[model samples]
Target chain A: MTTSVNPLWRFRGVAGTAWFAMVYLYLPILILIVLSFNANKVATIWSGFSLQWYSVVLDNPNIMRAAKNSLIIASCATVVSTVFATLAALAMSGPTFRGQSVINAMLGLPLLAPEIVTAVASLLFFLAIGMELGLLSVLVAHVVFCIPFAYMPIRARLEGMDPRYKEAASDLYATPWATFWRITLPLLMPGVVSGAMLAFIISLDDFVITFFVAGAGATTLPVYIFGMIRMGITPEVNAISAMMLLVSILFVILSWLVGRVKQ
Target chain B: MLSASVRRTGLLAPTVITLFVFMVLPMGLMAWMSFLEPGTYGGVQWGHYSAKSYIQFLYEWDLDDQLVLNTDYVGIFLRSFLLAGGATLATLLIGFPTALYIALKDEKARNRWILLISIPFWTNLLVRTFAWMLLLRNGGLAEQFLSSIGLVKEELNILYTPTAVAIGLVYSFLPFMILPIYTSLEKMDWKLVEAAFDLGANRWMAFRRVILPLAMPGIVAGCMLVLIPALGSYFIPELLGGGKSLMIGNLIQNQFGASRNWPFGAALSFALLTVVMVTMIAYNLRFKRAPGADK
Candidate 1:
């Protein structure tokens, strides 16, 4: 907005600092990806480029099982949370009700609460209920944690939408269900998809909650990576991490694109 | 056609119920258990309620059965606060300029830069911390590069130090700092800045008086986002500090894990929750007083 030709306006130092910050933020991830392909068993040194670690990760049953578990949990949690969040978004955005702010605050509580509290609370709750601390508990916890993430975007989308479309459908004698299915759902699809993608990423990358609530044989990839790192670093760990990072990056991009579609 | 309450209930019931059972109930249970005694083993003892766990946070029983003030847990809390605070400051220094730079860019470039900032955030935190480990270890890339450049005469063995933990925390939470500030800057009305300059205010004075105050909400939000999580983070310190550095998160985790002191763990957790709740309330009150500050 400032079109002045002042000498002070051409400061290049801030640009350089920004670039440096970006590099600092990204260099570790780039290094990890590069190290995952290094032939050396040692993580820090680069003997040469090789794909052996990727193969090693593939052959390892434990890593594969953890990946499978993460996938299942993320998928299930994303689906359930997205559905419920869509319903909630629809409800909250449709009517101006008393106590709506209270409901909104409750929805956001999990996001604001510290992860350790949520983790320990879920752990104790499972113990108190005599429920097995396995994939089911993990799934339930993930759904609860992810609903706020899914709710925000969907609610934003709903609020942005014009109410006239639904009114027109109703004036044409369309039932409420038909009006929803034909009018609302289609418009809300982009937000739903994006929110679900965000939730899936959160569920997939979760460590603290999974570490607390996971029983034997319920290790998610992040939890597995934590255990492996404690033991020692290895190229195989790097390989698995690289794969996880790739998946997460893909989902983030997809979410971004879906979010842009609403505009 | 449905009643307003019925419609509201129908839409919100599923999420509310799920969150209640999983989120609210667990918190309530944790609060309740914090008052009870820890069983000999891992779980809580049912009927014996006491404030011993809460008191134990400040005092410990010696062999002679006298309670003495314990500073070890207090030290851990202070250290956690210091680390989180340091990281938040570091992010502010680095992120403010970065957000400003992005805001000054063209719209397409701004979006790309914003996306780039988020990529690292979306990546698994464990993996990112592991990458830091690989970099900071002896003879690792960071050391090798620094030594090669004659920046250090000795090996860079910062992996297990408090410095490393701070670095990891900063790296982990930097994006949270950047995104909010960028949002504020991007939404900012540059006309006010132009007006300030036209009114004969110098650039520094304009930035100091006008830009900074307008960006306060984002700065506050970013600080909270980075500071709260950094305070409670366990893995960064555990991995980078190599068990030498202990924070409140590690303390709570130990009680729940190996220490098997459930009541003490619950009490520590409640302490953490109390801190977070206070921060949130402060933020809420601030926002309420200055509505549209964030937008």
Candidate 2:
């Protein structure tokens, strides 16, 4: 950590800009969080503090319904996608198979394609097959993109895992299935949990695709918040946004922490 | 005993089937829809194939049935490009230094800085844009602060403008730019820069000659990550750009909603897809050609 190693730290404005950039990123979030507690209806004004906005958000039946929908969709998508992604990760991390590269590309497509395009495509596909547009459709679509988020951590964990435990288990006459159950799966649990947390947050936070796919009676929290913001900015919207932001941050930090577990 | 290959296939089948049914097939359907004629009452008419959707990007049939050069869609695409391009440039300017600053930190501080950057990245895009709306809107924090500081005598009036959209894009994607560049810089051999300095090079020369080239891959990747999402961004423009500052995402949404031209909407999506694919392919080629890149 000598100065000679990276003299660029002394470069004028680099450190200054870094600090400014941090402020730029977090200042508005802080303001929003603070204003969520304001008694004033107007979001801009700094009226006396109150938790009335949170209470109002809770009391609103429409917001409550949307929150319920978001939780259901996120839970279902997280479970299904995490299970499927774990399987895929286990397979790909095993002996090399034919068509591995093709499968890799296919797995990456959802991340590469723009969400708007994916939304439009999913809408057309649903319409073409005459599928009903509802929460089911939203749930199906959520699983598609969530696969990659769920796959990444599990795959990383598999790569980092020592092979010696499985080797030892086999040398002791343990069946392959028994070895996997006793050794591999237990070791991969942290990554699976991390991936599930990530996928859950992503499904919860999604607005663009859910906006297009969700029909009547299928509104999610983000879609509801988007509608509220379009109507006007109120402390209620600020309160709801702050809540969603906090949930995402909590899940993300937990995901990071779980992924960092060594054993 | 089950063979390993059988076990692998069994394990992989669920994800493969899910992606094929949900992701690949839907995209295929979209491509097919783009070729079919538009239905009068929304959706597309099967078996009524036509090239009109793609053609309509540049020309529209006039009253006399003659094709006329229409710039409406083209203009929107251009504006989107300009705004997204501006955002990429701005993020690079701000993000590079920020990334370097983080990379220069000790391991403990580095992790903390990255976490700070990533929290905003993983947070909801809609909420982030809404945060900007609260800041940049008239009589909002930006206006109030600027006027309070005597920097401007009147309302800032920055929100609901392209500038506001640009700001939202830059802010939302800045972390995307920083994280990749920081990854590359953190793994870089600092001794190379020291070597350059020892060889009678100044700070600028060392950076320009040694450090920049080493960081090219991450910079390129960062630019792609920022540009692609910003280009197709829907909510940022909708919340911040108002009615007048329409981007291609809004334009596509309009075709699907108000205009009732599903074919045209599908076509516009394809157009956007083409641009993204080209950018990615170009990046892949450059990356593969880079020295020491694995095949």
**Of the candidates shown, which would achieve the greatest DockQ relative to the real structure?**
2
Q: Could you give the interface RMSD of each candidate, to one decimal?
A: 1.6, 1.5
Docking class of 2: medium
DockQ of each: 0.71, 0.74
Q: Model 1 residue A135 lDDT?
A: 95
- Off-target runs (Cα >4 Å) in candidate 2 are A1-9, A256-263, B292-295
lDDT per residue (tens digit) for residues A36-144 in model 1: 9999978889999999999998999998899899999999999999999999998888658788888887898898888988998999999999999899999999999
lDDT of 1 by residue, B1-295 (tens): 8987887798889999999889999999999999998999888889999999988988999999999999888899999999899999999999988888888777888899999998988889999999999899998899989988899889887999999999999999999999999888778887888788889988788888887888888888999999999988989999998875378888999988789999888888889989999989988887746744753
Worst-scoring 10-residue span by lDDT in model 2 chain A: A1-10
lDDT of 2: 0.90
TM-score of chain B of each: 0.96, 0.97
